[model samples]
Target: MPSLINDQLPPVRHYEAAPLTKEQLDYVDLPTIDISSFTASADPNVRSQLVAQVRSAIAKYGFFYVLNHGLSTAQTVRMFDIADVPFSDVDDDEKKKYQSRLKETGTQQGYKPRQYHHIDNGIRDQIEIYSLNHDVNKSGHPAALRPLLPEIEQFAYHNHVNVLYPILRLVELHKWEDMSESSGHTDIGSLTLLYSQPIAALQIRTKDGSWKWVKHIENAIVVNAGDAIEFLSGGLYSATIHRVVQPPADQRAYTRLGLFYFVLATEDVKLKPLNSPILQRRADIWLKERFQGAEVPTMAEWRKGRTKSDGNAELKASATNLGVEEEYLNGVLIKHYV
Candidate 1:
């Protein structure tokens, strides 16, 4: 119910890193379903059946799309239209302006889009963002900022602030690192996303443990489980793996727009097993999959408890043992399970 704002810049939750490769891209698919079916179901039994289907898709694939999700086509198009702007590319003067924030924040974590991604194609991604999470000092002001590093968002960010603000409240998190890399990861949370339909290149993992491509379906929105869902549901659901791959050597970084709406925990929510009998054994297996001494939090519990510091440094040391890239959210956990 509190607010979060940084002085120099807003709090950033999503991270942008280098894009994934094509060969690596061949591993997953986002699932699709019709949300309208909920309206059509004639009986409670049928509705339960649908919920079960949702649960199964989550456990098996960790990603899926919902048709008739209730978002309007106009809103969907406008969001992407706004996304067509080229914000990721850094000009010479812009880069220097951002450098000042790095000194003021006294943190390596600053506005760093250009430094994070050097490639700039013809039309760069117009989508720019600002973020704030868990800075108790800035909790009420909604403007208390850590210093801006490389780039600061335009004042127009507030135009959509009314619409976007409610979405962040849905988060239950663990430590949220800046997602700037070729490929990174996400904490297990309920992702209620509103995506642009005229776009492409969204892929997710599949039920058979394979990868499949999911193109944007008109008027439909995709929902996927994050690690928290998998942990809390005791393996009845899974935290899906997904990524945005670079178009080609000939391509630029500005792709279409994607707004990820996340719901996470406020404190360190434990993940053991659900009380459901069918899930107990799977939960045990999942627990075994977790590395020892890991800080596992449900989306809701972790977000409220996080303060940006060196806590993740302890995690960095552990991640080396798993043989995966260092930056993805659950790099160690994914490698351990997969």
Candidate 2:
């Protein structure tokens, strides 16, 4: 067991793991769009086609695959390799040195151990996570990761500038569970890009409220819209609800590694519907009620408060009000549903 007053463990030199075997399993087949088409040429027709496809995918699925995202497969594979350094290569003692101080910082930039998150039926979460912010220099990272900062920073920049920006331009846009390794919930950012190995644990909730596995595609980025996009689009775009459980029987024992980039709005941006006619037309009463006479939280406050409240037993117990799971931050009532 990882404990306080522990002596420092040996520095992590590197991590190596056998590749997981792939299996054909039932999964939610999400729409896919090649973002390179939108960025490679200024031809209006190509741009329009890409935009239309993205718009349709967002409206119907709220999630999709992004192809030819400019990063080579080797680069992405190396990231999962680097991720292993912190999560697997190091001892629990080493990870303890960098555990996240969520109560104080309200950020996910450090290590989060398995069972750190609360789940129902007295079951804590079954997976661990280590997150990094855009500013790589801000934290005292693991030793094995320090020498590779340049590569990591470049990768993060590519996901944001080359990959995320083009997709962002498509509509200017828009953008579980646990049973459970992760609990069911929607992401709180504008957009999210996930890259993972072929594992069958990740699932998305459908319109009928059934869970469907998200199949892994080699070298393709899984893209999903978050609450920020839904708010900005006035509910035109959906915020996907998804979660992760243990992998299926064939791949039950393999380690599942996922690489993700969460794109958040700037701290100063207000969380309100945009000033577009299309958005205005789609704005329903419930959406209006959320903001009417309510002090909307800026991205900073919303992110901070939500992060701090995520694992709070008291907050989770008190989350229900009139049968709705909610928390108040900066006078704004943020609601939650699986």
Q: What is the C-alpha lDDT of each candidate?
A: 0.42, 0.71
Model 2 TM-score on a 0 to 1 scale: 0.84
Please provide, for model 2 over 1-338, each residue's C-alpha lDDT reduced to its tens digit, 9 standing for 90 to 100: 11111135223333343355466666787998998887789999998898889889888888999999886766566667766777666687878998988778788888888888766667788778888777688788877677666666677777777787777752333220000001667788888889856767888878877778887788999999887787776777878877777787777767777788888877666667787777777666546576666666666766777788775634333333332355555555555443
Give candidate 1 regions above 4 Å deviation. 1-30, 39-42, 81-128, 132-188, 192-196, 205-211, 248-254, 266-268, 282-285, 291-323, 326-338
lDDT of 1 by residue, 1-338 (tens): 11123354323433232343333334244556665555566787766666676666666666666665444655444334333222333344553443323222323222333333211233333223423222312212111132332122221132123222222222233223311110334443444354524334655545444445655567565666665566666656556666554444422453445554444433345555556778775766677666344556543333322212112322232344442333223322332121
- In terms of TM-score, the best-performing candidate is 2
Q: What's the alpha carbon RMSD for model 1?
A: 10.2
Reference-based lDDT, residue 12, model 2: 35
Off by over 4 Å in 2: 1-24, 170-182, 282-286, 291-293, 313-338
TM-score of each: 0.55, 0.84
> Clash pairs of candidate 2?
176-183, 176-184, 176-242, 176-243, 177-183, 177-184
